[model samples]
Target: MSPSKVSTIAWDSFHNTVDGKPRGGKEKHRGVNPATGEELWEVPIANQQDVDDAVVSAQKAFESWSQVPMEKRKEQITKFKEHYLNYVDEMTDLLCEETGKPRQVAEMETKGVVGFIDFHLSLTLPEEREEDHEKVMLTRYTPLGVVGAICPWNFPIILSLGKVIPALLTGNTVIIKPSPYTPYTTLKVVELAQEIFAPGVVQAVGGDDKLGPMLTTHPNIQKISFTGSIATGKKVMAAAASTLKRVTLELGGNDASIVLPDVDIKKVAPELVMGAFQNSGQVCVATKRIYIHQDIYDEMLKEMVEFTKTIKTGAPGSNALLGPIQNKMQYEKVQTFFADSKAKGYKFAVGAPEVEQGKGYFIQPTIIDNPPNDSRIIQEEPFGPIVPTQPWTDEEEVIRRANNTNAGLGACVWGKDVERAERIGKRLQAGSVFVNSWEKPTPQAIFGGHKESGIGGEWGKEGIKAYCNAHVLHTYKQK
Candidate 1:
């Protein structure tokens, strides 16, 4: 059979095409392009039955898949990795079209996913680690059966792949529910996965928020990994409690970037913007807030503004530096903060009050100066291209302000002196800190949040542990 492009899938394996079953899965929702407000696609809303079916499928596939040896699982993943890389360009275009992200940003997201598939396969399912029989001590990691993965809209393909692929690599069958806004690209991934794995080994259910709770509460789902808001993360946790399911929650972040007195924001402003507004500030780890030292506050602010002026804000295909804000609600929420901040008394050093281009949700690369710390824009997770910055005198005070929020995802402190930056970075409350530079996610490195930002890590050896269970082999010796 030829590999035909499929953007949707049925809840049951009985149909190779779309499900013709009655419309009991809630209501059909239309996904729109944030850039043009055009109807991109309509995804079937999965109700309780759909979620139940997904869980049952995953659980069934898990029995046989979990029995596969680690080495064999690794080999299958290796083949899937090769096939995934060949399809990166296709995936990139789908991302751009669906998410309205910059072409380059979409490419980077797809590239991360491609690398993630290869990385997890190479890291997790290795042949052997020196077998030890002396102490009756042995460590074998096995899959947690069915994994119900709830992914966010931002970097849909990468985040979904980042979670599901690793779980699949470690022998866990997954039922992924991508955020309704950006399910198209992820559905494409599921289509590709079906060719390599069993029918229910890696399945996707695209629907509203309701499907998530169903999957989380399902008796068969052994693990639940979610990436979204703090409130929702809590709810997911609470729902999974009854089932006693292992849960991993990657939540919100209001990350900070500090520029020490000696460092030049002019030299680092581009990097800061890249880190802050890469996906139009829809990133969980984006530097949403900046706390610059008083000595260089004006200089850094000026440089940031100048650098911001050079950035391109347009539709996805333009290869612009920035893209749409991902969804309608997010765009309006961001616009409200900008409007409210300016109305109350804050200043926009750069960026317009409104969106620059098509009706699609887009925000100018905005920089707000000295907004009140108690203001909603400063205290809350903006999750947009808006960055609120202020000056501080004391190092301790800076750390205090940075850690004021409930989020402790990722933070950065830049300075000419690496030691000084490191000292400050260590003090900040975050999972990962960057001294002088922001480090992108690497396969060998662990990436997750502290506090409310996330419960578990992804993209490393530790990430593999998140998907597996340790077993001890005991052998009796007869003398």
Candidate 2:
């Protein structure tokens, strides 16, 4: 297929919802098209009163919703999936307009919603009763009441659904609070569900960061599933502590990638570029740091640099491989990384060190050449279109260097020597380690953080159990 051209005409306005209905908030906020700095549409900003109403509705609905039985709940979720598919095209446009994601990337996130639902639908809730040793024992996993699904601006649709689907499939109601910058798609997506799910079974509220604390600390909320940066995640954890709510935080990742001396530079260079710059390197698992063996460091970095040149960086709707930063705050944050690199006089192997802000938040993809191990770019999560490359001679030392940071969400190793790659991968301190390729999280495998990356698993069987409170029953058997 030819590359998608930069394009967008117009779209209808969206709204926040409560009790499966579109509801207005106390204030109004305009959604900006990050690619053009244009105000796309206005959305209602949920206030304290709005959050209280949504949570109360969700809590009220949970009484019946949680008891609806897993199979019945799945039926409603299946219906929600159908609704999502029908409106996915529209969601894609809103996603791109609001987040400045390339057309293909936006579509991928929009469609990924179904994949999450299908996987959750296929999963079975644990309900078992066993009798052994003249005793009766039973085990069950049940919902933990209303869940607060707070989403980040990056990859809003899939990440939001990743939290919402499991919560609903496990028979828990949800109140979604999307990032203020990227509210249109998430709010509209939940609006689609209102028709399929019962009143208050699912709802979405829109607001700035203030709504996050409101939802997190609300007593009626039994759980908080947040996906964002580490500093904000710490605040979420602290807020949840007020009510002692079950918190699942998928925070920032300073993920690392290791390339051994034996790998094919031609074959792996493109993958390295994607690993580092996918979604303009804003992904939680997007490789923040790369360690290439000294034997092949120059050649590998050269190939990776050339591949990055082939990546088109511009507005969404074009054949551009990357779009602009989603919001001003994050754009400025990425700019600071560039500023620090320039101040310290670090070598930039790919694009320039800094960008001039104009109408859009565009930052051309860049690869920072082998900065010091303790450099700011190496130790921090930029969440932008810049990556740091390092050279290593000894495997053991490289492994130690890779695992030195507190942020360990994902890591990867690439080499033809399967045994050697797996050996080094095992020692890497991360929640998920990829052997020959960067791991794309599926519903089948569990993905999460190791140190400060996150608190709980997000996919697979464990993901299903996360929303539930495990219960055990003991009965005396006739002897």
Candidate 3:
């Protein structure tokens, strides 16, 4: 695909939204196209005043938006969904340029956003009940006023909507702050919502490091939903504590995939590759570590390497299955792992120690063969295209190893026997456990982390409820 064909949206002034209109700031930050080492577009760098304006807008909007009928809110969301579907191609192009993900993956993220909207629409507000004569009880969910939502660059649209859609549906207004790395697509998405939602109902601001702290610590903001690194998540949590604001964090994950001895290597290898390398392995739930039963370890390793080689990596327009790393910071982070592996003389089943030098932040998809469990590659979440595989004999030992990490957003178990796979999968301490697949979360499943991975979750009925504050109403009889 040519560059012109991939992106048709005019690259013009990208501004922040306040109340329901686009507003520009004096200071600006340039968004780079990771696939080509070129500036994609310039977005405003929001300051304290901009943050204040956005939060105030959201708070004011919540006054009325929170009072709107549930059916009306759902109708607005349905309209937003229809509009998004119409421009899927343009959105996919913008997503690809900003994030360096393939067109297919970009499209998948857009589709995922639609699924989130549909799921929220399927839920009803908490109901009222009568326990006995002259006694009534009501369990109602109320919005948390102005919700501060911070989204990462990876899967920007879906992740942002994961907070935006639920919060709006539950009667809360939102002030969204998207990662500077990929702000255009998110801003555009919010811009679309402005048409359906009332001013302040949905708003977005783009800025540098300072923006996040401002959003979290804002006094008017009642709740926060953040998706990023564990370190930053801690900061967001601590800041929110100043006002004792409710927080929901989706953090890092060193997710593990455990392969039981009874599986077909051919069928499982491709799935494993997809699990580990999708979005160039920037996925939080991507399988970062793999543990194979020693009996089939050698055969599985061979099959995995052959299947991995078939995956191509290049710039955005190429027929590459994988695009460049999203940004320079991640590119350097992945390079450190390769450097350490080289120093320790770690053997690679596929990729080499050298980086793929070119116009983009491209790194070869690498698989390490049986690195020590103590190695950084094994213990840390690299969040790149490299993954490490180990061999295990005992089921209990492998389960322990998989659960050893502080991060546990997602885990997977593969085997021919369903009962056995479920048995092993249950032991892995992760939020979403996959039996035959990996890195795939349906709209209805609860997606979250266990330990350092995250606090709270998104998706399912519980996800929509996360944006709400539960209130109980009781009435006594005239007796």
Task: Provide C-alpha RMSD values for all models, in order.
Answer: 3.7, 4.0, 3.4
Write candidate 2's Cα lDDT for 408-449 as tens digits: 899999999999999989889898899888757677887789
Candidate 2 residue pairs in backbone clash = 5-317, 5-318, 6-317, 6-318
lDDT of 1 by residue, 72-159 (tens): 8777776666666667787787788878888887888888666666666667443233434443444677778888889999889878
**TM-score of every model versus the real structure:** 0.91, 0.96, 0.96
Mark the regions of model 1 whose C-alpha exceeds 4 Å error after superposition.
Answer: 1-27, 125-135, 354-358, 474-479
Candidate 2 off by > 4 Å: 1-11, 128-132
- Model 1 scores a C-alpha lDDT of 0.78
What range of 10 consecutive residues in model 2 has the weakest lDDT sum? 1-10
Which scores better on TM-score, 1 or 2? 2
lDDT of 3: 0.87
